[model samples]
Target: MGIEFPKVRVNSLINAQTRNWDVDLLQALFKPEEVQLIRGISLGDVSARDKMIWPHTQSGTYTEEICDHCKSHSEDIVHALWLCPCLNEVWEADTGWSFRNTVRWDDFQKLILHVEEVGLDLDLFAMIIWLLWHRRNQIKVGNSATSLGQIVACARQQLQDYNLVQPMKPATESANLHTAVTWSPPRAPFLKINYNGAVFQDSNSAGLGAVILDSVGGVLASLAENIPLPQTVADMEAAAVRRAIMLATDLNLSSIVLKGDSEIITRAIQAEEQSLASYGNLIEEIRLHVDSFLNFRITHVKRKRNSVTHRLARHVSDLVVWMEEVPSHILPVLLTEAG
Candidate 1:
């Protein structure tokens, strides 16, 4: 029940065959690990159940199922797991591990389960499922998502950092500490601006941003936005970047900071996630925006450092987890590291 599945989807997938989602799907999706789990994860008291296929969508069907991202028919388990090009990047980003292009439906289960039993982080194993479902949802909804690298990047920001923001030190004290007649962590403009996308299903998607004065206190912009956006959240983030840059331009400030919780979008802006094909256009858009700024620079920052924006983003989530019992897809899935 602690799992982050949408209740409607969860209930639609299950009725009452059994409640062992972990064991059922784990066994069905992964065979090699069944034996490994016999002694693998040291949580000695756990039990594996055979009828544990939790609420879920089956892979592959003779009936033509169209993928939302690609115009191709959704080819069941094989396509969802190992076939889609969109998912290809997710695997590498998720594990720094990749699968051969030849895996089949039966093999996918093995791979899915294999990833589980291989003595990895439990959170990681679950993230693979969440990510897979996310891609599947994208396909179902007719929207495009970034590469798996991008999705992994998205998950990376969901991690929660409990630390309170460090209070600003007095300029006199900070100067004394940094400029101590010794070496200084020279601060020309360590400032970073962070943004977040507050997306609402079937409604407007908004973005939030703030300017931080390096490790110290930060200031929130008076601006808040809501605009009609394309289906995919990454696209929304891309748009958010555009908005951030526009805001910076309007402020007429040079040497300003740019930041966001979206690593895929950030990477696209940084040109790290670009190649010859898919992301080039988006990258160019970001570059054009960057060109408009005089001394503006963009960098990645942890979501924790960008708390003000997170608060700003909370206002407009239409289908964004209304029930207290479940977590919304928009309500980020926190990962251990930021890409």
Candidate 2:
């Protein structure tokens, strides 16, 4: 049975003398495979010293006790790792971990089975379970449990390493390649807004910048502001788009073209793809705001063509806003695009 569980509980259950145990309780509580293991272990001599061994540890020993999480619930495979109070903390620490509310899970097996039914990534679920178990063990051994940051970092690194070791998927190649194109002004009477977000990972800060231009590339308004560092690049990009929409709406801009370099954001806005990523809530908010505009379209532009907005996004300072003009530093690039 492929399920998430701790090793110590398994050891204790297998090695314990269960002559007076209720067979019905055993069958009801465990899977068929687990029940078989119970029967086999019951046959072992009671005098045999019951030793708990965890292969990963140098001592090859494990401790069985109440849950380190709640210190109240019995420390069993299901309770210790998943049902404990710490479960929510671990999941909330990483923004990437989310599940649909329509589905319910009372146990780890039920959760895994539901994920499979919904075609969720099995590998990701397995990795998260492993990390949770590892975290639990750390706490049990008198070591502090790792932060959500550390757990997420370890999981991401392991996934990246695994991908690197595997063979790459083939890319579709076209015989004809098109030349790069610069950003084109929107149709007359429509205002164009170019936006980008820059993430300073080391500082855990992000900058969002947006430039509003008329049909002829004349700067109407431009603004740059700092935002809380989002968990992923897509989140930052989506935030930039959301801010642009809000700003444009405030100015009563009826018709607008919003452009960004991220294809993922573009697809999400166009409804061509599902908004199921870490930035899904932002994507949903963007959609609601799009309806507020008289006319709005989200399009993808190459990074080079988006230089003006990109440069505006590079900062780790307080929020700054410019109206009816471009910043002095970005004026040259603005003139170039306008020319």
Candidate 3:
């Protein structure tokens, strides 16, 4: 609880309407055991005034700090996670990674920003820091500290396991197979909206395309728009989705399916947990637009299946919208799919 959740009340940790624990906030603030204990307390249906209670006190009243595992006078999150003297061997060990000592930061947020600015592998940095905190908890419970080698190996193995389960990219052998398969129309009532984004480095701009098609593969509407380039390809792809949602709203279309080729963006949108990536805000906005539809789904497809949208996105010279017809450049792809 330290400085992170100072004087936080029980009511603040739960959803009032749903009457359920806020899983994300709990995970962020407490260790696994503490999270489970907090979640075990059943909430009453009757609304009552919330009062502060200290778990360590017998009468459930506020008191002085009970846990002082770290005797250091200036111990903070930055110190416990990275700057403590006990963690020196763990950080200095030959873990096939480097930790910068010259850079100075006062808090955990500033340290993370510095890591991102210096082009350090953020995933690895996060993994090591999490393991360090886990180890600190173990020590607090009188458990023997794990060796530096064991800590490094655990982090690497966890990372490797995580990557193995992620969506795989199309292999060279399957590229031709995927290209030969044409885009298929969505079933009954649902309109399929295929979107793609293109980056124009020379012009320092990006393009977005979205085409809405009905069950019989007839174009309901299509759009191509240009805007100043974003910081990354993921941002542009997210923008394409936002524009597509806006267009659907403009056309008063519901029961829609959104398809795109970016596995990263698609996965982020589909996840239950809030995204923490740089383009998280854009993803959140897209989620809000999606909630307006009666039925909404987002899907990922191979680039070849999204050829029509890809071509439209490359038409970045001007903003264009078509009704019941696509641009001339997209005709060949439509014909190919139909044939």
Highest lDDT: give the candidate number.
3
Q: Local distance difference test, per candidate?
A: 0.46, 0.66, 0.72
Candidate 2 versus the native: TM-score?
Answer: 0.47
Which residue pairs clash in candidate 2?
none
Candidate 3: global Cα-lDDT? 0.72
**In model 1, which range of ten residues has the least summed lDDT?**
330-339
Please report, as a residue range, the 10-residue window in candidate 2 with the lowest summed lDDT.
40-49
Instruction: Please give, for residues 1-339, the per-residue lDDT of candidate 3 as tens digits.
Output: 343587767677878787667877888889986775565343333353443333322222334522223565354566677766566666676543355465444435446645665687788778888887777678778888766557767887898899999876679747766556876778767999999987664565778999999988889999998866655566678778878888998899879999999887898889876655545556677787788899998899977688889888989767789999999877888778644
The full ranking of all candidates by lDDT, starting with the best, is 3, 2, 1
- Select the stronger candidate by lDDT from 1 and 3: 3
TM-score of 1: 0.39
Model 2, 1-339: lDDT tens per residue? 333344334344432464223445556568966664344221212232333324221112344677767788767555665556567765666444455323333334435545665686677667767887887788778787776457656776788899899875444322112122444678966899999987654455678899998876678898887755654466678778877887898799999989988886788788744355555556666777788888888889877788888788874557677888867978888776554
Q: Given candidate 2, what's the lDDT at residue 244?
A: 84
